[model samples]
Target: MAKIDIRRPHSLSVADARSIVDRVAERMREKFGTDSQWSGDTLTFQRSGVKGAIAVVPGEVHVTAELGMLLSPLKGTIEDEIGRKLDEHFA
Candidate 1:
């Protein structure tokens, strides 16, 4: 398994950060059939080969995921896509 850990500092409020994360979750669900839910400030998401959480804090957003063996090889691509999304949303 491969792990993806991305942290980005943001100026948005917790609520706003959550909104962005929710949008991201929705896209993931629509595109990849992911299952996601919110537990306070964290949004946890999972699918067959991926599992992750987006945590919204006062000044930052942290994304962490574990990829199954089959998906491990594409880790860089996945991470880059995520970074692009984060840049679009928060940067």
Candidate 2:
């Protein structure tokens, strides 16, 4: 399996950051067919070829995931897309 780990720093309040992450989750569900749940300040999501968590802290959001073999080859593309979304949402 391949892994993706990205940490992005933001200036928004915790609640606002989490709300944006939830928005990202909804987009993920629509585009990738994944489901997500929140546990404390972290949101975890899983689908057949991907499993990941997005954690929100005081000044950062951390994203981590493992891609299954079938999806591993596309890691760069996937990571880029995540980065793009992060930029779009949090920039």
CA RMSD, predictions in order? 0.5, 0.7
As a whole number from 0 to 100, the lDDT of residue 90 in candidate 1 is 96
lDDT of 1 at 22: 93
Candidate that would win on TM-score: 1
Candidate 2: which pairs clash? none
Clash pairs, candidate 1, are none
Candidate 1 lDDT: 0.95
The CA lDDT at 54 in model 2 is 98
lDDT of each candidate versus the true structure = 0.95, 0.94
Q: After superposition, how far is residue 41 of candidate 1 from its true place, in Å?
A: 0.5
lDDT winner among the candidates?
Answer: 1
Candidate 1 at 44: error in angstroms? 0.4
